[model samples]
Target: GLKSSHFITPTPIQALAIPPSLARRDVLGSASTGSGKTLAFLVPMLERLYLLKWGPLDGLGAVVISPTRELAVQTFNQLRDVGKYHNFSAGLVIGGKPLKEERDRLSRMNILIATPGRLLQHLDSTVGFESAGVKVLILDEADRLLDLGFLPALRAIVSHFSPGGPNAQNDRQTLLFSATQSQDLAALAKLSLHEPLYINCNKPGEEGVVPAGLEQYYAVVGLEKKLDVLWGFVKSHLKMKGVVFVTSGKQVRFIFETFRRLHPGLPVLHLHGKQKQATRLTIFQRFSSSKSALLICTDVAARGLDFPSVDWVVQLDCPEDVDTYIHRVGRTARYQSQGKALLFLCPSEEEGMLQRWKDKGLEVKKIKIKQSKVGSLHQQMQNFAFKEPEIKYLGQRAFISYMRSVHLQKDKTIFKLSELPAEEFAASMGLPGAPQIKLFETSKANKSRGGVKQPEVEVDVASEEDEDHENVAAQSKVSGPSLKSVRTKYDRMFERKNQSILTPHYNSLIRHSSSASESEEEVFTLTRRDHDLPEFGGSTSGKSRKPLISSEDLSKRKLKAGGSKKGLLKIRSGPDKVIFDESGHPTTFYEAGKEAEDIARDSKLREKYLDEEKERMRKAHEIDREVARDKKRERKRKRKEKEKEVSKGFFFLSYLPPPPQPPPSPLFIQKWAFQFKVFP
Candidate 1:
């Protein structure tokens, strides 16, 4: 099979690591990616199983743990290929697949390949799990696993094969492999390996260097112009197959949309952590087979998946560190193939990291392209007709999954629908209808502001009754008694008395009232009045009453003088004097003569309405709680019933006579007699 597959010569890692691994010795291998490390461990794993004559009934012979689902799938494929001649059975366990389906196939598998998290889930949940018969354990991409915060999961998985664990056995061989060996990997080896043989196949000056066949260059541009530069490059290389690495899933969607719009006929795909496992695998297969293809993705695709004959690797942004940069570029120049890598750098942003790349023995050159050309490309892209991106329109189920993924990525328990840039993001992905987003409020502080406290108000926007009630309350404020009517009533109340009324100071009183009805209303009217009278400016006698100034002039003069001594002259309209107390919170009077009374009334009405609204909300919340509780109970009851059915189906088997016990050895019988004073 090796010869048939063209494995004529061993790679450096293969030659050094294979012999010991085949000998059943634990091996800790460190070699740069694309060094054929997969075969280095895979060949030996198959050879050992073949030598042991392991078969289906022998239980699981080996368990391989990968950091990512893609890698796990890739490794499983390779294992299948190597074990095909031996007729060995293998199975895969990862997320995004039906759990029951995977559980049903466990009994027939001789080798299992899985991601750490998913494998741990099965270890705890799967009944009759064939873990105790495992003979080998392999952790691929050990450093990447640790980098992704999977150390705790990895430890839990390792414990499954330790003493007293489900997979406990004496002949377990552990193999650990990675491109880089960090202190964390060293510590992990202490816990996972037993006096392992250390294999380092890295070249002397190739510690942080990309493959020699990969030609590396970078283009410097402004932050705003990166998309334009990227478009120009992709446009120029439409026929070339390549991968574009971005910093985030959002960027993956953005770049894919931009390019898809510019060249609607071209084959373009995107993969991100948030995508469904099945969708990701489909996209991966499609990209691998397409002759002229583009894959826009995040770091999820950076390490350890074999992509064939890639011509270019474009890093849309500077990678976080050197290892990431190497792995990304390594995706292209695999198996000594010639490839090009272009690093797009924003002006002055990551220049330090670029310098560090040079210092770390990587050969990188800056590729200069005319800014005018980029500008021209940008203009051309603008002129192109906008085509909707080729993203699938999400149904309700997919939309819920999408939202749940976004929330999980943010590590948020509650997410506000209004806060999500849903329309823009959805349109970029060419989703047809706007998502019906629901707002969830959480008790935690705002994470974006470094845990700053924020006030939260929960309202059910879905309730039409609540909305109508709010609308009615607002309308009543507008339609209630006009300020002019209140002023007229005040004038009527005081007009019966003949005593001359003075210029009133309306700023010295607080009036509180409700707008519900006249009977429920309470108003406190305060006015400062003067007893001395001044005539309107013609006759001095009381009957004519025209002595000082016009009514309009007197009013303006009184406003400008504002309770001053000069404005003390009384202007008689109606004849009742109202006095105000001097010691109270001062209120300003506007042109609306009854403004104070109106405001006081509105405040009381609002308070009453708010109380009623609170009661309604409380009732609605209680109903929602009850519904959720009922659903939970229904689900629990169904699960219990299913368990009972399964137990009943196996009741006859349980009642069958237990397998005959084997006769005890003399030593075991003597020990048992000593402990219990009885022996058979």
Candidate 2:
């Protein structure tokens, strides 16, 4: 039932390696990016796995380990597709996900795709894989796995399948794949292979072959000018669907922000190591499935992750080494398809690296770019001279939101719009909606006609700026105040105006906020009105009525006297909200000093407890030292006593030696001995 098209169109790596691989040969594949290396081995491996179908009792028959979660997930997806018609179930086990879920899924999977760390964790635990009837072990990105210091773990895992040993195997198959093979990989190959049929896809003197269907180009510029060059490339090469490789997450965010600020419609995604697993998966899925493709990422994304239709791979940062250079460009021209690889290099550093690459037999063709060759957006920015920033179609706020999102952040605005009700928008903006419009300050001449409070009047949209200026000026022109006081007042007024305009936007963007303060009165009342009323009636039902204070009254009291009892009443009446100081301390305007004292007291108590604990530890150490000294002395005394006893026994034996001098030998010998003894 296999399609003829699939077989005939096998990629170069596949064509050269698949047959030998199927015949159970050891293959050394040196294919570049976009080579059909995945399928080349996957097909043969799957065929072997299918042949070894050990029934439902056998959980999995094959294992694949990849460097990254994204790559692992991607490989798992591809494997799932290939195994679909074959009725084989595949499971994923990667970091940042529950191991138990993976363990449960393993029960149903016929194959396991996992990251190194998580896989090792599962193996060390009660989760046994012997029942899975695992017949093959594949280390995809074999070089990367070794580079990540997974050798000990990998050896431990391999030790489990030593035939006729504790974790014995029933005839095994081993496949190792990498974009580039190093010495460590060779050592690992020995451990995995038992006289494998060796095949090398990249022959000597073919370093820059680039899969025959790939085009490569390089641009030389200053380090400072690389971002500008990238922007130009992106604008001109809109047709290309691919990734931009950067050196750091910061750079990923920087490129993302730059492009987003230039063009809002560009659907660009940023992928990096620091992002949450779910977020990275969503980004990967979106880019993989959609046509509007431009992914900006680090070299962590350079290999084992496949995107079949990718038309370009732009290296925004110069490669770390020759192998990295190969891996970065290999992202394009994958799977036997035609693609392009572009490298943006700094002028100062290009010569040495270029020569090194050439010595390695790589021809990095240089491409020229002039200012005249700049794209539309860059051209416009270059030509237009202005003091203020140009007001473009995309609003400042929207552009900033996009920029933040590109930092691989979930844009608060996007989340806000998705999660909130429309009515909350007006309140978020600090303005009442149309139906609830209580006061209007539109006509300055007719301010007295509507019976609205003069000081509490809201400015109309057309005159809001004028009102802000007037208020700022008035606040600044304090006659009976010190210069510092006037400056403070002026700053406070300006800050208030700016916040009043921007708070709604901020509130709208926040997915979670102070519900007690931000929610509407109706929401607040509904949530608490009945709940606060007790089933058992309180005694204060008919107490003296509290005076209803106006907003103006509270403000006037605060200005006249910094703190008053009535101000406390006003604060208590308002919704609960935290007031933080410059140092991020929780404090109230009235109780700041007392709160500071309480904080100091708590800190002192904590230090005192720690000191006590340290003292106790010091005493315990002294006691241990005394005990050890006593034990040492006791051992020394016992040794001395034993030595004394041994010495006494030897001394007594020496004194009794000669045993009466051979029983006086003979009568004449005794007489001669007496004469000799007397002379001695």
Candidate 3:
């Protein structure tokens, strides 16, 4: 397997550590990252298992525990490559996979590479899964495993193994390896390293160091300028493949989203603890194979993972400690490859972090950012954030996460939250305003590191130089009333920004930083934009702008805007009375408000008169209707009488028809007589 993988001369750590382990002696190896520590321990491990002739029925022959799933998966892949010829059945057991699938095949795995939490969980719960017969144990990143944070889980895992055979010797051959080796590892861990051979290839007393081929540098930038500098750097190095290490998952997500939208001429990806397991693995694989891409991530990707052909490693935020910085840079310049690193430091942290690096024998070149090289993104960012509520929301979350991460830092000397320019940072992210954050933090790390002597009080952040809104003033003079009592973390959490959490340490100190004010909401800005600085910077256009209209038109526009009167009187007469006369016009009732009030005062009398008038009208209407009916009857009678007379005339004419004919013949003679009678 080694020859097929192009194995040549052995590395120094591997050369020394593998031989002792081959002789059945426990080994503790320490070396710089990517100095072939993985293969060093891995070679001995596979050889030991092969020599023992371990089989699938050995009840978990080897257990390798890594701090992260990425590292565990990596070690497993390498194990397969090294042991492909052997008949050892191995399986990876990590979180984010179906428990049933893992349990169904778990008992068959002769070798298991897993994270501590998952391993401990299986030991405590998985049926028929036993590690008592385990023969070998390997801890990758042993320093991380031995830290106080992970010590409890490690102890439980160690307890699952059979007790050391004799004189604290274990049933298994343990191999412990880490880049940062220290005596504190032994102090923190109990009996994990027996009378084992301690191999250290690094310089003694140094925790960690940069690779020989890695060029390290730092830029002392204010928190407000960090984003712009990072943008400028990424813009300048568009074709370079690298990782941007931030403090929190939210920060990673925000940067990834924002930069992706900006289209920085490279593929942008993000990985954090919050992503799904499948998503993380997919992203990890993509980044590893990608030629030119930028990965924004939290510390989840900082340790024990390797990417090929990476050109740069940018630490946008200061690392928690020197060890982290070493490992972060170790991701690049692997196997003697050349790489570059850049760190951003605020002025407050510059002194302390420089001293720390000097103590560790680490060297970094200090460089000033050139204004010509940097692209200011604050205006564009603010515009986008203002338009997209989603971006604004993400900006807020990222802001809070950043503040929380800074507050949670164990090294208070370097990670001073008060020194950060939160409002400026928000503006750089395209946020209209800085999201509010309160740093009332208390943790075991704080106590251990002496970070916050007491839980820090949170008040409206104003300019540190502004005495009017000082934290002391806020506490001393609360809005409503003063309460002389201590509040718990829960109480503090429910406490709104309006309420200030005061402490008994009323030393009346005016602590200030060169950057932003203490809290986010109380940021005190010292300068205004060129457009806003009329008195200071003059007009933004260099020459004053005059209105583009005639004076008369301008006056008309101004008059239209407000306070203009109509030429015609808008004298609104009182609303017409509800009652109307038969002529379809308004009644004569008074509509004046005072007259209506007087009428309302006499409403009882008016109502009585109205009722009497209504009754009288009803009686008069009945009488008129009866008179109309009588007239109608008289007309009908006249019509019937006329019809009867006409009918009688017609009957008389029919009976006297022959006599009329005779009378007509004599009419001519009687005509003269008729004429005389008519004249008479």
Instruction: List, residue by residue over 1-680, the lDDT tens digit for candidate 3.
Output: 88777778898888999888777667777788788888887787788789888877776888888888889988888888877888989989989998888999999988899998888888999999988887778888977765525677887798889864335443577888889876767853346656778888888667576678999999998888887888899989988999999988888887887788888898999999999999999999999999999999988888889888989999998888888899899989987789999999888889989999989999899999999878787887777687888778888998888888787777888888777777777777877677766554343544443244444344434333234335343663453123444444454333334324555332233334533344533565454323322222223355683333343434555535332334112222234456665777764566555556776689787797789999999999999999999999999999898777666655554554344344666566356434434222
Q: How close is candidate 1 to the true structure, as a TM-score?
A: 0.57
lDDT of each: 0.70, 0.63, 0.77
* TM-scores of all predicted structures: 0.57, 0.53, 0.67
How well does model 1 score by local distance difference test?
Answer: 0.70
**Candidate structures ordered by lDDT, highest first:** 3, 1, 2
Best by TM-score: 3
Best lDDT goes to which candidate?
Answer: 3
User: Stretches of candidate 2 above 4 Å error?
Assistant: 1-9, 129-133, 163-169, 374-680
Q: Tens-digit lDDT track for model 2 on 244-352?
A: 9876675565456556656735588999888889999999888888775789998678876776588888887666567777777777666557878888765544666
In every candidate, how many clashes are there?
6, 7, 6
RMSD of candidates 1 onward, in order = 26.6, 35.2, 31.5
Candidate 2 whole-model C-alpha lDDT, 0 to 1: 0.63
Whichever of 2 and 3 has more lDDT, that candidate is 3
What residue pairs are clashing in model 1? Answer: 513-601, 537-546, 537-547, 538-546, 538-547, 539-546
Model 2: how far is 577 from its true place, Å?
40
Better of 1 and 2 by lDDT: 1
